[model samples]
Target chain A: MALVLQTVDLQKRFGGIVATNDVSLSIEKGARHALIGPNGAGKTTVINLLTGVLRPTGGRILLEGEDITDLEAHKRVHLGIARTFQINQLFPDLTPLETIGLAVSERLGMGGQWWRLVGSKSAVVEQAVEVLDRFHLADVMHERTATLPYGKQRLVEIALAIACRPNVLLLDEPAAGVPEAERHDILAAVAALPKDVTVLLIEHDMDLVFSFADRISVLVNGELFVEGAPEDVARDPRVKAVYLGEEADA
Target chain B: MMAAEESGDASRTLVAQANAALAARARWSPLEIAFWLAAAASIFLFPTKHLILTEIAILGLFALSLDLLLGYAGIVSLGHAAFFGFGAYAAGLLAKYHVVNEPVLALLASGIATMLLGFVTSFLVLRGSDLTRLMVTLGVALVLREIANRLEITGGADGLQGIVMDPILGRFSFDIYGHVAYVYSLIMLFALFLVARRIVNSPFGLSLRSLKGNPLRAAAIGIHVNGRLVAIYTIAAGYAGIAGALLTQTTQFASLSVLDFERSADVLLILIIGGTGYLYGGLIGAVLFKLMQDWLANLTPQYWQFWIGLILVIIVLVGRDRITRTTDPIRALVQRATDRVWSGVRGSG
Candidate 1:
């Protein structure tokens, strides 16, 4: 399989504090890869670096074999990379459909035309509705996204990422604030993404990770601990001592 | 998952095509179109004195320039009057010393001169937040006023005089009827409005709106937010300069008070009364504010400011949005009645 993305010795330091340290990883095309780590292990930082939100103190990132380390986040998005935040980053006043439609327009490289009520454009609105529907958000298409429940908000955020039509999607803790009852639904929706779309997911729940991810990379104290198939990683003694100890209690 | 993906892709494609079609058919918003039409009609239709119409047109253009920066670009400036005053002085000096004979050259000189000044100060203004930006703009205006006062060439407090604006387009000299001045101002106002409208409707304008809503998100989406803001701010300064030049040419004088805080305050008040982000709001607000002041001052000379102050207080107390919604309740009722009558006629036909 062709590798879609690779990070080479990525490092980020805030004075003496190392947020990310010599981290290197590769994502195969169309594969569901998981990045698992404890708190402060820099999972979100990694996402930021990949999406161009934060610059690395050292190292390089390659998308389709072209280095994009110096690219701005939005430019990276146009290059077929998109991400969702751990916290919902949405236009609070806009409808979910409108939010998605704006993303679609950006992805398609349309001029602003914002004052022109492009919201009524059937193709754009239809695309927005389709993404919403995939996440079961049709009824709330016209409703302000801020009014949606936490779980639904997460789904809408995901829909926005999908609206970009990026070749690689980075999901930062899709189930972070989700209620237990709605957690399964979130996992199932993410697991259902198109096979051609590569996903790099940062999830805390071992159950969701093991069931959904094809491969898992463990991180401890800003360093790579181990990486392998879920079953082997689960059985690894070091993994048990660190990640599994917390999982057993959950 | 497969079913959801299929539906999502299909709907996305459908929405894109539908949006493109709808966008193609959409016209300018009712508020904007109605405003310009009404303004144009009133200019030709109203029985006001010619000089007053001239003042209205000049003031309207000035307010519109401020609106471009504050309303559309989200740059809250309190010193825009400095550019206006600078343009007036520049044009007046040019005309006073026989530096330029043609009105068009004076106008271009005024605009380009202030634009260069704006470009120099834009870096300082662009680095600050709203409050800081306001202060920087106000500071610049203050400095310009002081400089004008100090310079003998600018005529100190006596103002720049002997500004005989040569015949516009080499015809229709400004006369006692104020016909040429009024018509010239009106045409320039209309032209500026068209350019402002075009700029605000373009991709660049949309980027401004996005930046206003969320700068971080805009940057994340690949926008060079700071560069765009600086460029727009400078463009707005150029508009302000032209407005100043128009006033000086039409009136044949440039006063130090043009750069005064009162001028800036009036522009801000006009924007507030009319609404922000709507191009025509500036014109409507200027006309209404000026009319109110003109009428009120004549009625109660000593208490004119007091009455106006009270009106502003009432507006703020009642809340701008709510008061705006209620401003034309009576007119709205009349409109509804007229609509029903028209529909009844059509139905009978």
Candidate 2:
């Protein structure tokens, strides 16, 4: 697989603390990559650095072999980088359809047209409906996203990110706070995404990580401890000693 | 298997219906048409009310501009009247010096000048939170007021004088009855209201609303948050400047009162009274505020302010949701009637 995203010694320091220290990562095209570690292992910090939410102390980020370290967050998004937050960051007052519609319209560069009604754009609305259908959110498409159940809101968040039609997507804990019974919805949604889009999933659920990730990278204390196939990482003593521990089977 | 297929078909139908409903919601409702018609008819119904009506139009435009910032863009400005007063002075000075005697031309010039000022100051407003923005905007207004008070060109504290506007379009002179002023201001208000209506209904408006809901998510979704704010702020300033120019042309004078703290506070109160987020809130609020001022001030000439304050307190205590809730049934009733009529037309055709 060709490399779609690369980080070169990404470093982030908050005062005396090194939040992200000398981390390097690469995501291949069509790769279902997972980043897992113990608590405060800088999993989210690295995702933030990739999404341009936090500036790296000293490093370079390359998207499709082009340097993008200096780009702003929205500019990064325009460059086909999309992310979902650990916490649902959504417009509570807008319905799922409206939210998704906005993303689609923005992707199409029609987000700035002030003279025409957004609904009148049938192509955009159709695309939004299609995206909503993929997430199984068609039934509650008109209901305000905030009023939806927590699991469903997470699904909507992913739906929104995918609506951007991104080439590289960083999902930060998509299944966080979701109940067990509803976790399958998120799992199914992730599994259904197009294969050509590169996905980097940050997760704490070991079962989900093991099952979904083609490749797993273990991080300990803001540094990559090991990276390999899920099975190899699962059995590796170094990953178990520092992070996975004896819970590898469970 | 049969049940699953049926449910799938039902959901598809539901999605289609929901999309249609969303589109319908953006169109002009019967209530909006009725309200505008009644407003337009009022010009002829109460000929003696021209002066007050003209005042409402000007004040309505001013409130609408603030709504675009505070309601849609989530930018709370405490000194919007700074632009209003500046435009008033710009128009006043131009006409007083015979620099631009044409009313429309003067209005445009003044509006552009104030828009430039807003563009310059938008950077400062964008740098802070709500409280910080309030202080900065208020400080700017205060500074401008003091400058106006000290400057000889602004006639210092005495205000600009000896200003005369050429007949509107060189055809109709502004009369004491305010006939031309009323028509002129109403025309300007309607034209600008159409522009505002178009903007708020468009994708740009939706993006602004998203920003207002959550700036972080807006940016995460590829919206340049600060850029949208600055653009709306500049456009809003132009609208407000035109409103101020209307007042200056109608009254043939620009007074220091235009820049007063009370002016900004009053417009804010008017917007809240009418509600926000919707463009009509300003127009409705201006009508209610000016009419209440007219009635209450006469009833209690000494303490009208107390009554206005009491009303605001009641509005707050009652809550905006409850107020709208009470009217929901009536609105639904009207909606049903309109739907019936529309279906009848479709069926007959």
Candidate 3:
């Protein structure tokens, strides 16, 4: 498969702290990839570097073979790289429908049209509704996103990212803080995403990572410690010693 | 296959309802229609009240401009009067020097000048959080006020006087009765309000609301945050400039008070009274504020400030949401009715 995104020797340092150190990654087209590690392993820093939220101290980022290391966050989103926050970052007053509608309209380049009502753009609103329905948020589609349950807000955040019609999506802990009962809903929604879009999921939940990721990359101490098919990574002794530990043997 | 058809029908119903809700928000509600009609009818109902009415109209426009920044874009500014004073001085200088005697043309010139100022200072305002923005904006206004005070052409603190405006459109003179001035300011208010209304209902407005809600997410979703702020700030400055020009043109004078810090604080208070985010807030707030000021001044001319301050204190104590709570009954009725219709349609489907 063609590589959709790649980072070469990505490094970020804050003072004496090495947040992301000499990390290199490749995401292939339509790949179900997971980046897993223990706490403080620099998974989110890597995601931020990829999404242009934080500039890499030294590295190169390429999207579809074009260098995008110097691009702004919005510019990267415009280039079809979209991401969701580990903690839900949503407009408190806007409904899920309006939030997603704004994303869709923005993606379509109709966000600057001041003469027409947003509702008048039927195609954009329909697409937003479809995306929301896919996340099973159709019932509370018009309710304020901040008032929704934490899991549902997580779904809305992902829905917003997907509304951009991105070529590559980076989901940072989609199930974090979600109740155990609602974790399955998030998993199912993510699993049902179309395979034409490449996905990079950074998650701590091993069950979700094992079940959803076709290929897994384990990060230990801000470096890529191992990469393989899910079963192979599960069986790898080094990954076990560093991340999975005794759980891998079980 | 049957289940699929049912679900499709249900989804369609939901979409229709969503579209209807969006449409409802986009247009003027019945309350807004009533407000406009009452305002229009007041010209005849209170023929002697033109002077105060003109003041209300101009001040309303000023408050509306601030609302666009503070309410919609979430940019809190304490020096919005810089644009207002710039417009007033620009118009006054033009008329005093015979640069432009045409009222409409002078207003336009003043608006553009102040808009340029807004564009330049917007970078400064956008650089920091609310506190930094407040200090920066306040600093800008104070600096401009000192410049106007020390300048010769600005009348050196006495203000630019003898601003002789020609007949508006070569027709209606600004008579002592203030009929023409009242109508002129009212027309400008209605026209600009339409523009603001159109903007807030559009996609640009939605994007602004999104930014105000969460700038990080807005940027993550492809909104050029700083660019949007700069554009709206410039546009709002132009609106405020026009309001100041109206005051200068009608009153035939531009004074240092135009740039006073009180002007900025007063407009901010006006918006708080009316509630922000919506365009009508400024207009309604102006009406209530001016009428209360008139009544209180008559009752206690020397201590009216005390009463106005008290009212503001009450508003803050009660919370801004309480101002809108009185209208909740109507909003709830409409929402409940819509919900029933949607549920009914879904159940049948």
Cα error, candidate 3, residue B182 (Å): 0.6
List ranges where model 1 is wrong by over 4 Å. A1-4, A13-18, A57-67, A93-98, A112-156, A175-196, A220-223, A240-250, B1-34, B44-48, B93-109, B112-121, B146-158, B299-307, B324-349
- Which lDDT value does model 2 have at A63? 96
lDDT of 1 by residue, B143-193 (tens): 999999989999899888767778877876888768777777888888888
Which candidate number maximizes DockQ?
3
Better of 1 and 2 by TM-score: 2
Cα error, candidate 1, residue A88 (Å): 2.2
Candidate 3 lDDT for residue B213: 88
A35-76, model 3: which lDDT tens digit per residue?
998888999999889888899999899999999999989999
Q: Each predicted model: what fraction of the native A–B Cα contacts (within 8 Å) does it retain? A: 0.30, 0.71, 0.79
Instruction: In model 1, state the lDDT of residue B124.
Output: 83
- Which segments of model 3 are wrong by more than 4 Å? A179-185, A244-250, B1-10, B330-349
Report per-candidate DockQ. Answer: 0.31, 0.64, 0.76
- How many residue-pair clashes does candidate 2 contain? 0
Q: For residues B1-349, could you state the per-residue lDDT of candidate 2 as single tens digits? A: 9998996787567557666767665767788888889878988998999999999999999999999999899898889999999999999999999999999999999999999999989998887789999998898889899899999999988899999889988999999999889989998999899899889878889899998999888888888888888889998999988999899999999988999999999999999999899898899999999999999999999999999999999998998889999988998898888777766777999
The window of 10 residues in a row where model 3 chain B has the poorest summed lDDT is B24-33
lDDT of 3 by residue, B1-349 (tens): 9999998998788788789778767655556677788888888899899999999999999999999998999999888899999999999999999898889999999999999999999999887899999999899999999999999999978999877889988988899999989989999999899999999889999899999989989999999889899989999999999999999998999999999999989899999999899887898899999999999999999999999999999999999877568778977886666567665767999
* Candidate 3 chain A worst ten-residue window by lDDT: A241-250
DockQ of 1: 0.31
Expressed as tens digits, the lDDT of each residue in A146-225 for candidate 1 is 78887888888777787778789898888889888777776677677789899999988777888889998988888888
Looking at candidate 3, what is the lDDT of residue B300? 100
